[model samples]
Target: YSIFMCLLMSCISGIGRATALALARCGANVTAVTRTQTDLDSLVQECPSISPVCVDLADWDATDAALQNIGTIDLLVNNAARTSLQPFLEVTQDQFDQTFSVNVKSVLHVSQIVARGMKARGSGGSIVNVSSQASQCALRDHAVYCASKGAVDTLTKVMALELGPFQIRVNAVNPTVVMTEMGHLAWSDPEKSKKMTSRIPLGRFAEVEDVVNTILFLLSDKSNMINGITLPVDGGFLAC
Candidate 1:
């Protein structure tokens, strides 16, 4: 039997790196789409199963051209996003545009490109979009970020509805503050972190594996019946 191959594109954050490594460990050939060649080189070193396609997802033409060459895709993850922390009234136009460009537009572009391949191949596939708990709940200084994730959740549902007949599953994974390097940097202050963690029934932020495991489940046949749902790996944060 041939090994399963999954094309996973992330913004090369800690979650993306961990997810890529885990997929490789499971014996899937991983093609990582990232903008930073430095992160790409380091990730490829960490896991030889990964191949690199360096393209800034914000560039529609470059991303389209790049993915056009990836051949076949059995699974896809749209994990690229950008955010600026500011009050709704303080948010600038550039901040809003940049956030939407990467957070919302890229998801549509990448998914469309990959889904076309899946549909044409007729082998079916799974798509997981990394969203956030902020999409469901209001957070201070997260107006733009929250709005973009909400778009992703809606996109997930619509994709699932439209693609189900083609046997392609689409879902979104919404996680609370994950303790990645970036996560830690953003939430390392004990006072700030506690405010958020206290609301979670789990009483702690998520680890990298928490999100990765969920993505793996969605990609595997174990979740064959699941589609269009935004599954939260946030330790019950959204429930509160």
Candidate 2:
């Protein structure tokens, strides 16, 4: 199957890179979309099988045009997002717009584009939106981030309801404090890390592979019946 994945930030690191490599290893032809040529080069170096497309998802028009070129894909993963950690009152208009544009609007636009192709092909397809645990629970300094993810959760349900007749499965994966480079730096403080991990029954942050595995499952036929749910890969943080 052909897989199309969008990773807004650096393509060489984080969930996007891991997902691309994993999918390629599974023998699926993977097309990775990102914003930087440098990161695209790095991703190609890491996995020569991945086809890289450079397009800024923040630009709706450009993203739409780029999606048209990708043709029809069997699977789509909207993993691109912009996060701003600031007090609700301190968030600037630009910051809010930027965050929503990348996190929410892009998902809507890209999914529409891809879903149309899926419908045209007369075959089923899977879409996975990378969400966050912040959507369901409150977190300090995550007002906008939480709000964006909340929108994603709602969108997933609506999309599933509308697209299920066409044999399209839509779902979201909500992960908490994944141990990416940025994740480790953000929670590097011993006190903060301990306090956060203490709340999770697993007592540890998630690794990229954890998120990748869940995504793979959701994309695969194993989750054929699952639709419109935001499955949490949060190390049981929400259980507390």
Candidate 3:
């Protein structure tokens, strides 16, 4: 584990930040990538073991350039995503493009770059794409976001198929609403929260640690046989 090298995207906050910190604690040499310098600085200050790389993942050219500099990575977490909530008819082209750029295109680019390195090294690697349950279950006002995540899910399957031969494993984690700061705000209304929770068999929203732990399991040798699947950390929301 101490020898594990992990490159995590969107480590500025939320599930990304939690994953980065947990990885560092597990003795992985973590490279935390995010867009803001201040947040990167804060992450490093909080966990000095993490090496921060600041780059806007939405910018394809810049993201590719930045990732090129980071040498061989054993594990990669494509956790950067943009969600634009709008009705199908109200969704603008910019919103659709932006959502796909961050959620789908960026993941494809980063995974391609990292998987190449893994193949070259001949050691193989694990890649986890942070997708949403919305990809499978539709929600109102989430047309564009859901489409982008659906693309991500499809891309993950294709990547897994192609890379499995190289001993590379690719998977996506689709979680129900996790109680992050933003999650709390978005689902703050008690009635809304209750309605949502009633659907989940677990009777509550996912915690950041719940998702982080699943991610760690996927990255570990324990899940070596698992590949080409999207594991839902949704408290069985999809089951119902």
Best by TM-score: 2
lDDT by residue (1-240, candidate 3, tens digit) is 322222334445589889888998888888877787887888899999888787887788898788787876899888888776788889999988888888888888888888898899889889988898999998999998888888989999999999999999999899999988889889999998999999999899999999999888898888999998999999999999
Give each prediction's root-mean-square deviation over alpha carbons.
2.2, 0.9, 1.9
The local distance difference test score of model 3 is 0.85
Model 1, residue 96: displacement in angstroms? Answer: 0.8
Please give the CA lDDT of all the candidate structures: 0.84, 0.92, 0.85
Count of clashing pairs, candidate 2: 0
After superposition, the stretches of candidate 3 with alpha carbons farther than 4 Å from their true spots are: 1-12
Rank all candidate structures by their lDDT, best first, as comma-separated numbers: 2, 3, 1
- Give residue 239's lDDT in candidate 3 (0 to 100): 93
Choose 1 or 3, whichever is better by TM-score.
3
Candidate 2 ranges with C-alpha deviation above 4 Å: none
What's model 1's lDDT at 182? 81
User: For model 3, where is the 10-residue window of minimal lDDT?
Assistant: 1-10
